[model samples]
Target: MIKVAGMLLLLDFQLLPPTASSEAAKLDSLFFFLVALCGTVATLIIIFILYFVVKYRRRTPDQLALSGRSYRTLELAWTLIPFAIFLFIFYWGAKLYFNLMTPPEDAIEINMVGRQWMWKVQHPEGQREINTLHVPLGRPVKLAIASQDVIHSFFVPAFRIHLDVVPGRYRTIWFKATETGTFHLFCSQYCGTQHSGMKGDVVVMEPEEYARWLNSGSEGSAASEGQKLFRQLSCNTCHTGDSTARAPFLGGLYGKQVNLQGGDTLLADDNYIRQSIVDPEARIVAGYKPIMPTFKGQVDEEQIMLLISFIRSLKEGREQIPPVSDPAGPQPSPVGDAIRQSETNANAGNQPRTNANSTDQE
Candidate 1:
């Protein structure tokens, strides 16, 4: 537990899949069961009241005075029955609520900020996502949600959980989708006229698929378009090669430990990657000038993911800046590493050849 100016912020990141965990399934079942019970009870009460009214009505010729007296037994039954039912509901609801509120030891933490008509998601891996949310299926996804504007609700109906996102404070909610598929997201609170139009998909996919999606460009799997954008922006110029470039070499960077210039080491995951791209000042890579232009409003989350994908791929090998169409194609090269090595080898070979020529001339 790390101290933060006297306030304790829990760090829970979920790495395990959802099916392997039983808590989410239990809460889902309990929630529907209680809802069903409420509906059934209401139906029965309405039917019973209707039946008594019809059966106990006095006929037109009856001269007896209609007493307005209430029955003690009837009142007691009504009061006790409701009280007991409420207690039952409260206990069951509280049990589920507690489970949802308190995350498991291994639950993954996702920093989620709700802005006007959009969602800004940050992964521990320096991966950033907009509108779309991709989480490994079956893993408990605990979202630390806050609103940039008014109130919003992070809702995934399939998970049967919704969190109220309030400004000036953080609200968290967790859910593990039992099945993998694209789920609907709705802002439960009415924020603006477009509240109904503000929508996105919560894709609960297999872990492999999630990884592929993260790496993949907007156009294909395994490489994101952001990777292409990174090339277009010429980010590879300084980030790769032995050119005495200012920034960290992006090759083999994804999932690798990065030693920041400020002496801070961070895992080059989603959020870190996003911040480094947009706000390079946050965690300076030590040697590189913060000369990186801030992408702030210029780049969206999808583009950021693509850029991250490209960086992630770069970390693995000297592949092409624009990853080739074929996976078997050659990887992009470091801006200057390969060239520098080739130059050294070429110079060494030439020197020996030159000496041989001089011997012949002598």
Candidate 2:
């Protein structure tokens, strides 16, 4: 509010939406440039049209009209000038796009699952929030998003980030916050009957505040959950320890070239690993039988993300998802530690943590 003389007046007036992230400001700059350029061109065209209307008007009723003519120089100028302008715009837009899409390697990964009319946000430390995301200010954050049912678009206007959340696959987006505040989150796509209700808030906090906020309600790391699921499904029976003779070793398998059954080697990427789990016969590993059963209906997309995180951590060893300690003292997750000691015990011929009811498969 601003006081003018003895009157109080509202000071909030703008032609653009609020921008809270670095990406938002950059995008706004481009958008503003486009609006200015187009407005200038349109204004000039209108003025010229009015000028010609008056200058070349039929002043006398008996005066003959000018014959239709064309100027090659004018034609070339119009064509080439617009063409050059378009090319420049394309290059600038493309560069901005690639920069936004390519996230820094050090960026922290955050997961989001869209279902019904709410967004389920999961932090790397395993804190889950419904329709709310808490991120540290000035730090790069990557979002791995997926949907449970229909398609939903994750739209954050203040951050200038909008992405589709499809049911069958995972899509990723990134942003680095420049302003610390709460921003609105919405589903731009018409998801369902309650699409309008699919809204959330992004809270950007200071580094110290964010660190303390993370320790509030964590369920444990996602990898720890994945590791527990591995034991529940008896995945460790054939993927590690004593089962390498029958199935391929899973440790350090991610991002590596693995020979297929037909003299072909396939990269164990996220897609390949996902297909291998849901549809085992899609690509069989060399010396391994096509006996692995499909787990499509058994595990959901969120579970698949957890499994992938677990797999990615496998290459870096069990310490990938270590216990997060706070100022109080060292606190360990019950399901944390990535089954290190349990696997060691199993290797020592002690009773393994495999479920007896589970059928063994590669």
lDDT of 1: 0.61
Candidate 2 residue 165 Cα shift, in angstroms, is 2.4
Let me know the TM-score candidate 1 reaches against the reference structure.
0.52
Models 1 onward score TM values of 0.52, 0.80
Clashes in candidate 2: how many? 0
Candidate 2 per-residue lDDT over residues 1-362, each given as its tens digit:
33553253355545566799888888888888999999999999999999999998988889888898989999999999999999988988898899788877657678899988999987655567899999988888889888989999999998999898888777888999999999899999999899999999999998677866766555555655666666566665566434444567766677789999889988887678888888889899888888787888999877877776666545423332222221222222221222222322222111133311111111
Q: Per-prediction count of colliding residue pairs?
A: 40, 0
Output the worst ten-in-a-row residue range by lDDT, candidate 1: 353-362
What shift in Å separates residue 268 of candidate 2 from its native position after superposition? 2.6
Output the number of the lDDT-best candidate. 2
Which prediction has the highest TM-score against the true structure? 2
Q: Evaluate model 2: give its lDDT.
A: 0.72
For residue 82, what is the lDDT in candidate 1? 82
